[model samples]
Target chain A: MATDRIRDFIRTTRPDGPCLVVDLDVVRDNYRAFERALPDSRIFYAVKANPAPEVLKLLADMGSNFDTASVREIELAMEAGADATRISYGNTIKKERDIARAHALGVSLFAVDSHEEVEKIARAAPGARVFCRVLTSGEGAEWPLSRKFGCVPQMAVDVLVYAHQLGLTSYGVSFHVGSQMTNLDAWDAAIADSKYVFDKLARQGIVLEMVNMGGGFPTRYLKDVPSAEAYGQAIKGALIDHFGNQLPETIIEPGRGMVGNAGAIKAEVVLVSRKSDLGENRWVYLDIGKFGGLAETMDEAIRYPITTDRDADEMEPCIIAGPTCDSADVLYENTPYPLPISLTIGDEVLIGGTGAYTTTYASVAFNGFEPLRSYVI
Target chain B: MATDRIRDFIRTTRPDGPCLVVDLDVVRDNYRAFERALPDSRIFYAVKANPAPEVLKLLADMGSNFDTASVREIELAMEAGADATRISYGNTIKKERDIARAHALGVSLFAVDSHEEVEKIARAAPGARVFCRVLTSGEGAEWPLSRKFGCVPQMAVDVLVYAHQLGLTSYGVSFHVGSQMTNLDAWDAAIADSKYVFDKLARQGIVLEMVNMGGGFPTRYLKDVPSAEAYGQAIKGALIDHFGNQLPETIIEPGRGMVGNAGAIKAEVVLVSRKSDLGENRWVYLDIGKFGGLAETMDEAIRYPITTDRDADEMEPCIIAGPTCDSADVLYENTPYPLPISLTIGDEVLIGGTGAYTTTYASVAFNGFEPLRSYVI
Candidate 1:
């Protein structure tokens, strides 16, 4: 949903070209809700989701820690008034030089999923604290974090042992149920796997200190999702069942959930027409597309709710495409999107739940179109 | 293949981070080849493939016309020393305002596939020369452009008729065989479709003057494609068979064929590891991934030949991925790529056949990594 502030900003300013408008108030509320839901777990805002300076500054003011994937993100966090202790290098795949750069910038927490990554961190960051990420099934996640990321639980044990031997603190275990995960019980199996790793490490006299639960919290899109309180209760029940009252320090990295529903994209219909007189569906072209900012719509996975001024008119199915010449820029074709029959060229539409991944996924200048502009109010 | 100049530049400068190096000499040579192969057809270099200033300047200096997708691309071509007469607003889907802007910039040639688009040009550019694009089967292209662009052949005739009625010059018909088209006969059916439109419009007293044979020229990747001379001969044969001695003025757009082999990307191996002891293949993480510049690997469609220092060593299948935290960044996983067994972290590898569609497709900063840097020498 577009917050009142965002809607008013667009109605008044009327910025040229397609752009995303984010309401900081909505983000602030989302942050507070997460804090209330998971009071025991520290919130580390994932910088990759939406690293706009205003978003970073607001979250930093709220005392949120930062989960960064690169040295540039760590610098962005630090620049937003966060200290080095409040930043964690959370990407499991990193060059040794990047690891050293993060260490030099005072980042002490690092993530590792492989022996190679562990070796790099050990050589570059020395005695940094490392958390081993165990693989998850990602069954219920719309955007599954596939096997390309974490390792098997058994391999995580070996990775942690190697880190302990290399003088790096084997901090704990972590797992992601995947982005836009909907199943409340998705965290139960992962928490059990973390407990297994913890028990195996403890038997070797190497005690882990924390359990870093990677981000999976979902934001409302075309469908309603489980509330943050429901996710917190489900996760808490899993933690209690696995750890038996000896709970480890917990941390949650929320990327999309914190910012996804806080912004909206304003785009105009570029052209609308049928291929032939008997063509089945009309093709509606917009200024923005896969290369512009709506990349999460790849494969039509994340279908954002679209609202046009002519919503009261009779609706008709239409294929939505971007303004670029590339055929792959079609946003919705497998399942045609229904739009008002009265919709015409130059009509304005608002796409909701686009705050998180939209801006950063935009191409630099594909077809001479500029990257998605962001206006934080 | 990376030309000697590009390889030498990379070896000597050793630029930091993953970067693309384009050899202007190779681009010049490619332009010469296209001219020699299709002596009767004018060449319009598609700017969307590689809009680098040096590339545009080289083509412009060689008397090549430009097919631009947006107003900025038109400005870029003009800045590169091309006159407005040599530039065509080639994208069929455009905002009316963009059409007006391009017209204001003195661009008189436009492309339209639908009556709605034709109307936009008619209102914005008044009497601009317009071409109707007919749909093709896209049978033999590796990257098959689906029905997102172009219209049925019959509809193209209607569109051209409408453009002429609205005071726009119904100049001709156009169709793309699809990008990276490998089949030498792929243009035959499209050329036939254009001839049908010509005959249909001629009966209506709106004689089409040109057949804008759009870009589909292939670039060599892992497999060798038909040469420019072979494609030229096949296309010329199709034109002669269709029109006999009454062939219209012809224009061919070549984007990838002009620059795909002229550039190479220098990337570093970030990490290499297996998930478990029983895992079948190793995972090789590179500093660059789909979001970095290799977006054409969306479904592992374009497999560029990679060369490493240890290429002579024993080879094994590996799942290659980027350094981002996103799981979708994996380049080749369904069919793992075979790499040298001795390849290790920090090793330098060169990805060839990346001159086209690489830099422009890069995300601004997906995971805090900057957009793909380009160095044209």
Candidate 2:
């Protein structure tokens, strides 16, 4: 579906270099998949994944809730016609000014993991609805959401209790199993931790009535990532399995899975050559790289399955790189990716499943190269 | 030096969030330092290192030649008042349209490695001055130039010959020792390889007239990186050692080395907390992170020495991180960094020696956060 869309876009647009091609059709399908699997849950579509105006407008028109992280994202969501009440500020780290601004903009819901952050929110946005994050091991995540966020069960309980004391609305508990998570058990484990934090708060007579299942939903890439239905079913089962009939008003933050397959990048192969005479290793350079919208390729963490117009039975292993002069512009070096030996300069390279992070992560003209241009269909 | 400048800027400007403060006076001083050190060499200030307008204007006003990688850079250099002849299209992997557009804009110098790129140059901008890159081991460089660009010595010879055959001006051979190069031997070795390529070109009836000693000059950070004078002396010696009295017109593309020390970033600590009860390891979350602008800290490679308003004799080991929700936002995790235990949320943390790659590497509103605002004084 993406190939046909990309082909049609290329035939019409004919981009000279790298271009992001976003199809709203695939996005609508992905949203339906999530809805069908978790009919009981609310979708707080993570705005950070792909904050394209068209994508937001499509989701907002469907009355989807949004997971906003900053004041700007809150504004973007609002501008896209989503009600402020339908947006939740999910980032634990917030500036006081942003907190005040978001609250003034009517974003009453927030997420917190630290005592200092909770205090800031209380000072800046008093009476805002808040959620506590319990730490997850973040194992089996392509990009582990580890160490950067969340707290222990005791601390999570304390954060909620402190929120209640500060006259803030203690709403729920949240956790990110991590981005591109494959193992459903990781969510099972995180839910178990969230239950501990939730039960502890319930005992203290604080009935936090929301359960935020943070974003980590995977989209199809190089591997057979679990379908959105599979993830939604697993999460729903865990919520019931862990909490029984006491399941709180549920929210699922879907970023990557919601939009990853909906977009693709059409990049031109700038150069292709054999690096060493001794080894059979071939190096293929594209106009897009780490600083040029492919920052997700750091250490080959997020592999965007690549294909070219040129096909050959005799494929050669190659390392993919960006056009920047920096040595760190390499996209893939460790992975043994085989490309058609017939691939040559000026050939089109289509990187699939790049809709979510690719355009958003582009560097601001690292080498005088322009930011990635996206064409939404 | 940067602390005082930043404090003065913030006092006067009153920036609400992360600010990139670049002292043009310091940039001028750094430029003068390079000019004084490498008096015999032309300084093609690599624009990628810091594409700030003020930085470009200051360098251009001082009559410094620029090393531009793309058509946009060429326009920026020209807009900043640098003569077209002074700006070389140094990126080897360029689209033909960019080449044609840059040529129409009066740029003549271009760098090429592969045959296809050479052909594109020939077709788009015939008679453009060209340089071929010979592969370097990229040893003794912090970021290791590795296998991204450049070709073998044999390919270099063939490329130069091919450029000449295509009626393009085969000017010389170029090679990068890699970014932030510490070992002088890498340059010496690269110079030797350049000589091999140069000599091979000369024997083929083409007298190449330029040698570009590509950027890699180190800047002072956590450790005592060699001074600009030290690098200039070693490079001067190596150029002579390899080319002797017959040395061609030389160019040094000093990017980070020229502008790295001239800028500093004022970031606020969003949160600081211990990860778990068992481990005493603290994490200091800053408003800026890898996506926000400090992308050079790939795997703890480029370390920026940090200082805070709050200082104490009592310190704790900590991992620095950016405010983004991505787990990959962690900046430093490998090395032992001791931070003041008294440091808390809302404290201003100044990251020093960030002038070069900071602003240029920031993602374009990643997570709905604004680009790093730069104020050149």
Top DockQ prediction, candidate number: 1
* Residues A1-377 of candidate 2: C-alpha lDDT, one tens digit per residue: 25587779888879766889999988898889889988888999999998999999999998799998788889999999998899999998888888999989888999898777888899999889999887888889898775778888788888889889998989999888888899977788888888887889889999988878888889888889777778877887888899998988888899998999888888888777665455657788888988878878777888788877666457877888888877778887898688898888778888889899888798877887778989888
lDDT of 2 at B145: 73
Q: What are the TM values for chain B, all candidates?
A: 0.99, 0.97
DockQ of prediction 2: 0.66
Compare the candidates by lDDT and give the number of the best one.
1
Give the CA lDDT, 0 to 100, for residue A101 in model 2: 92
Per-residue lDDT tens digits for candidate 2, residues B1-377, read 37576679887888888988988878888889989888988999999888888888999999899998888888889989998899999987787888999999999999888787898989999988899887888778887777677888888888889899999989998988888898977788888888888888888788988889989888888888777788888888988888899978889999988888888889999888765566768888899999988988877888888887665558887988888877788898888578898888888978889998888889998998888989888
Predict model 1's lDDT versus the native.
Answer: 0.94
lDDT of 1 by residue, A117-146 (tens): 899988999999999999999999999888
Model 2 misplaced regions, further than 4 Å: A1-3, A276-279, A312-314, B1-3
* Residue pairs of candidate 2 with colliding backbone atoms: none
